[model samples]
Target: MKKKFLGLLIFITTYASSQTYTTNFNVNTNNKDIKSIVDIWQSYLKTNSKEYWNTAETKDLKNFNILNIEGVINPSLMNWNFSNLILSVNLFSEDSYLIKSIFEGENKSVFAITNVLAKKENGNFKLSNYLFDYTKNWRSHSSENITYFYRPDYILNVEEVSQAEKFYSELCKTFNLKSEKLTYFIAKDCDNIYDILGYEYIFSKGMSKECGYYEIQNNYIFATEKAGANHYHEITHFINKFYPNANYLLLTGVSAYLSGEKAHFGKPLIYHIKRVNEYLEKNKEISLSKPFDFYKLDENTNPQYVIGGLLCDLIIERQGKNGLIEAFKNTKSDEEFLQFLQSKVLKKNENLNDVLRKKIKEISKTDEFPNRLKN
Candidate 1:
């Protein structure tokens, strides 16, 4: 009985210690190299600990259904005394998916790591973490390729350059943006853009991805790829950068209004318009309600852009151009944006029910409302 109890105690201790990974592997490659890598990971885990998993930026990192990190190393060839050694790191995540790199270190060196995602007790793969180099060059990650110039005044290459330019020009005018300072780019990889700008407005490449906030930076937008005029949606996101933490409810409606983009699923025009009119009538009184879950519908719901745009237009009509701009420029969290709107825009006795009804009646009273739909 004494022997069995001692054995059980030893087993429990081992299990508890194994719950956290504290092992380190020093490669024979180079002392400086290995130490550098370790430093980066150590610093990152310290600042971005499991606690940050709940923050808006890396909430997904806390998914917790992942495997242990597998391998990490340097991939970039360019190096100086210490710069080149740090940039190479490749990490693999859940399902053995390769998540390339994360920059860490004193100089913010880039590392590419490979991870093998762990499975739950049920035997399905999930993400672990990354593995990469620390023993080499750290500055190799800071190249023009990794830099994004955010001058919203610049031009971008897309399908309709002229139309896009015109659209941006008008939007800048409406929002008091200095168009000469706007810089833009067209890139295929959102991850790359995220690294450069610390934020991105990605139009996804496939299904299974819907429009939502992506952590490429703490708050960036990624839209559905199939959008006909994706730039409009993305630029609206660009405009929204001015209002970080503004509620998606207000942001969505306001952006759609500013960019003249509409909500679209796979649906016909007239059918979509009718659905919009119905949704507008049903939720007209719920100012926050209409904009909050506008994108939460399923396949049966067609292009909601028309209605979404209209809703934003109604806001502009009520608030005026400067009001919209002030909403964007306002410094507040997601909750504060809503609170301000409640106190200022939707003050007591200013019944949105009557306001919306009158607004809708006035909007629908003219052919201009439908004419705006001719995108």
Candidate 2:
């Protein structure tokens, strides 16, 4: 006879003045091993939960000492493969509550944890309690914020659904530098995205190649991807949206580089270089002479995404991150951004046309357009 076993689980929640988190489980299984594990967890709560809660940090959340957690469980959602547990706790000095809902259903579950930070008393944010609700009423309220982007249709690994929420949480932290209300959607494809965002397709990825698209629309970013959901790269474009004066070359190139480099799109760096180089070779005259013009796509034209992406990396190498960031903030028009870049970084009395032309030549390692004078 084979031993029947359910997956392992641990859900904890902590509350205000307690500095610690507590967890409750709703295990659904006749398996002895699963039941034994569940019993051990319950025993720990009976023995050490109070001790853990007392030692929890009474001060700010960032500095707070959080033990395991304290909360109730929802038994209805519990199954051999799926478990839904809710942990509610009070936080800081405020009377507000923080709710953490941990759902491990199927391969991918949603870890929706909301911390209600209230600074009403002494302007100091206090600890709040936790609650779980499948209805999602407390998400928009309770001083809680959610920045999530999800595409249920595109989800292949159902076991990793929680990853989507986790990725969105990181994006909020990295780009916004703080938590905010966020939600993600699933579109049928790139074309379905157009109805929501009025962007004409400037350039799209090859049909065989899996790629992500990030574009600025009405000073906001609208991203479209075939499968790989890269929120970080798309959010970068959203952040840079404030810089209307930013160069298109910087926009596309930096977005791509960050998508591949910072966000780790799994594509080797050389792959990007080769793609850009191939496109440059095929469209030598258009790319070398005029990058901005080349990016404008028609039935016959190819997008300058790779060229732009490489240029962004070049700028980062030449100018520090701060310099590039400042460039985005300072420039408001294409001409202005290019002029600002040239004046700030290049040789004295450098002609814009010559500077751009030479820059491309140096990077590409070929002067395909030597006959064409830099105007």
Candidate 3:
């Protein structure tokens, strides 16, 4: 069965590769016409009229491949309010051009750079491709179940990839969730991951060198440097698809608990509980009752993982795993879901916040908390 699956995978990839478009062009970054062309395109974005596009067109407007080029540029540019834009053009050939632009937006204060490919038809340059730079220089690999994109020199091991596939499948079954086709991007390191994702994007900001993230919208997992014992942390986020409205506390805490990575560099859960207890003893200001605003906190300063993990474990102990799953599926919003957890799942007659703090101290006494430092 495995051999047959491998063969089918090979056939699909080969066929897909054969169908991709081929283009011939020389890359020249120092072209004067490129800036003029980009300025016209910017005007088109600002005015939302074909007249600006027509002004930069080398061929009939109808013949320009707008579909192919749109993917390379920011889809949000259609709404305007972009500023501090810098444009660079690379002449792929006498007739083909690749234009790169970097700019910022007011909405999220996001910084983005995009590449647009243009080809000359009948002595006019027509847009051919527009996309993020990460889409370029990527090589694809597949296991029986998952497809991953990686840099040329940073391929993941086939056995490791296969293991991740099996782990994800088993998790779906465990959670009683339907599986989706998973894609992984094995970046050389965390910096490479940031480059693929724009630097100014909120998700890309404040991340440490060891951290990689899963993009829920794109259905892709990015891991830096190492795959690290099945990527169970990110996979947990992917598998908990039922809880679309769950708060970051529940989401990050549950994954941190299950993955065991947040526990003192992947130490046992009790160790993390003890660490949080210790942290709380020194710093009395951090409150578990409030929602964790990740945007305000630095990447490494998250207490949510430790406190949240212990809370999740408590929920499982008192209410059972199905009870936790029920809370996830039924909750309408972040606030409502957290209230449900306190009222329904925790079910303590006393103040739940005080109860959780006491529970953390109690759990710190467990044998799982190591005596000698593992590090």
Score each candidate by Cα lDDT: 0.36, 0.38, 0.53
TM-scores of the candidates in the order shown: 0.45, 0.42, 0.65
At residue 60, what lDDT does model 3 achieve?
A: 31
**For each candidate, C-alpha RMSD in Å?**
15.8, 20.1, 12.9
Report the lDDT tens digits of candidate 2 across residue range 1-375.
Answer: 000100112332211122222344543326443333334333323343322221233332321212121111111111122233434322333332332334333333442222322222333223222211111231221112323233433443332334444554654454444543333322345443432322122122122122233322321222344443334455445455455666655665555454433331334333444444555556646534344554433332124545555455545556755566667676555577666767775557755445454455464564221211011
lDDT of 1 at 243: 60
Model 1 lDDT on a 0 to 1 scale: 0.36
- Residues 274-363 of candidate 3 have per-residue lDDT tens digits of 766787777677566653431123333345566567656666676777766765666656577667867876655666567778887887
The local lDDT score (0 to 100) that residue 234 gets in candidate 3 is 69
Candidate 2: Cα lDDT at 181: 38
Q: Evaluated with TM-score, which candidate comes out highest?
A: 3
* Candidate numbers, best lDDT first, in rank order: 3, 2, 1
Q: What is the full ranking by TM-score, best candidate first? A: 3, 1, 2
Could you tell me how far off, in angstroms, the CA of residue 251 lies in candidate 1 after the best superposition?
2.3
TM accuracy, model 2: 0.42
